[model samples]
Target chain A: MSESRGPGRRPGRRPGVSDTRGQILTAARTIFAEKGFDKATIRGIARAAGVDPALVHHYFDTKEGVFIAAMRVPFDPAVIVPLLLNGPREEMGERLVRFILTVTADPQAREPVLALIRTAVTNEQAVAMIREFMTDALLGRAAAALGIPMLRMEAAFAQMFGMLMARYILRLEPMASADPEELIALVAPAIQRYVAP
Target chain B: MSESRGPGRRPGRRPGVSDTRGQILTAARTIFAEKGFDKATIRGIARAAGVDPALVHHYFDTKEGVFIAAMRVPFDPAVIVPLLLNGPREEMGERLVRFILTVTADPQAREPVLALIRTAVTNEQAVAMIREFMTDALLGRAAAALGIPMLRMEAAFAQMFGMLMARYILRLEPMASADPEELIALVAPAIQRYVAP
Candidate 1:
């Protein structure tokens, strides 16, 4: 219980500086990574961060709140929506796969993806959030722009996500270690056909 | 703790036909089905079964042991290996996919498949078991028989299991509702290509 903040009082009491909140996020990310979502506990995080559990609650009302803060996986349709929205129907799969590989291959984007998969099986809320993020940001924008039926959009996601989960999450030997380009090459067409005009 | 067996063994004979074990399996199955592993607890299963925690432990060494018993999923590689081992190179995909879909479509085969996925996320041992089940029974056999490398085999599994996880486990619309035949038709060729000579 190293949390110096008295109950209900903001820890920093300083404007534009949130060192403690940042520390908490750091601690939460480590714990979530180490223990996964379900097994990691608030008490454990507070113990790790050297902060009061109360402060954790104050900063984040629930575990889900902490998860959102810790992961910070942006759900903005802003960045990716236009990628799918502006694409030609026939080329959507190639574009989508290429975009995904680019996003995931970037160092910054990789960690959140790892966190997402780690939590999907361990936390129902995280699983729900993943589905929500996909449906709201990527799939919804995609199906609408391409004028494909909603079902096809979901099918495409199922295929795409399954590949990621199998390759990255489960670390299945073949897919887990495949050359990204080869993976993209094989999978891109499947994606293309799913939403293609 | 409504256990038939109390602390320190009774001198009398054992309970008839192991009624409590059956009860525990039932409760565990229900809990696992409803909660999908992360939330299901042995204590909870025992309580639901009107038995003591120790009795639950007595029957199954750990929660995992309980899970292995309760889910009762057939994780046989030897039985499944032969089915996949036969047939010409060209028809392997169709034969393999047909076998998987047809078997899983059956009520008996489906439950264990669900249980396997549900538990794989929450329990490390469950993950190990599933990995063994797939590798030993299915993946390794296919790779060895087809003379493909391990990496390609894993990639194929990523695709196959990914499809199964998305379509069956999450039951994410369209896929959950799609005709199995249509799914096999679209995806079987991909599976075939991955495994074929």
Candidate 2:
């Protein structure tokens, strides 16, 4: 596939002939917000962007890829995955919890993650996309690296997800207002039990 | 107040006063859905209901009260509070987890609670109302009965809340489909650490 390019770059409706990827992303975001993720399809997005469905696939590969690109989370899971994997196994819980707290401490930095969560709850497509991305790129890798079952990794993640929702969204007292260090100390052990090899 | 009431004839809008309460609830719900909890005021609800704002106050003491009534969950915290407090301290975690699972297992019963969670995320007023109700009626009583710190009880609750969100709302697998007994076994010890006397 990489050997087909010429110096003139033949401009036709064929794949890689035009740059309509950004337009498709914009259309996808609008449709996702209006109709939600599950109902919004590649064909609909392509129609909105005035492009062929094949072009959408050529650029983004899948709806999930378009979502991940559109959502644009503030940090890269790739970086966090390695950090969690390379850490001391015993202290992995604390490290992961602390990382979540640290990253989310700033309101602006936390918006994209929150938006993804909000969208996920409302849309099955978003849930599947997030779950796949999280499992394939981050949690699954960590579980394999630590030699723990995938279920255990998911449980630990579920707890942390709930904790974030309670603190940031529900604004429950003490849990919401507690020092991050204190919370890390309190919750890390529970997480440890789940993720520990 | 009791002295003012006659034997067969109670005075001053006793309980069923022209079905205004129900009307107010409907209006409050509409307004809350359209404008969210914080932005939807008692005056706005009264306006929507075509009643005087004073009538709204007489019917439901505050906006929080109106929101709670509008978002009426099927179960009563009063009943569950006694159950949790009266149970053996060691088994409180299992009892609470089981209770949450059992109640939420039914889709009809779970809808209001899920609605409350969805609304609370977007609206601070909803959060404050839910948090107060949870703390004052349920968690606070359990903490006092067990002689555990309120903060610890809150942390335990936060984890359970997160677990529910992950399983039901986020549809995170394994946690979503895990057998109740297995989940009880896995999470009870963690909950016990937070609530145990």
lDDT of 1 by residue, B1-197 (tens): 12344323453644455577876776676667666666778888877666688989999988878877755444355554566667676877777667767767865456556666656655565676666656666678767877887666665566666667666655555666778787777666666766763
Predicted structure 2: clash tally: 1
The CAPRI quality class of candidate 1 comes to acceptable
Q: Candidate 1, after superposition: displacement of residue B140 in Å?
A: 1.1
Q: For model 1, which pairs clash?
A: A3-A52, A174-B151, A174-B154, A175-B155, B3-B52, B77-B137
TM-score of chain B of 1: 0.68
List where candidate 2 sits over 4 angstroms from the true fold.
Answer: A1-67, A70-75, B1-67, B70-75
True contacts kept of each: 0.38, 0.51
Q: Write the per-residue lDDT of candidate 1 for residues A55-171, one digit (tens) a residue.
A: 899999887788877665433456655776675766767878887776666544455555665676545666777666566666677677778876677656766776776665555
TM-score of each: 0.67, 0.67
Q: Residue A56 lDDT in model 2?
A: 88
Alpha-carbon local distance difference test for all models = 0.66, 0.72
Tens digits of per-residue lDDT for model 2 on B1-197?
Answer: 01222213433445345666776776676676555565679998887766689999998899878888876544366666676778687898898888888887865456556666666665555667777877787667777877888778877877787777877877766778899898888887788788873
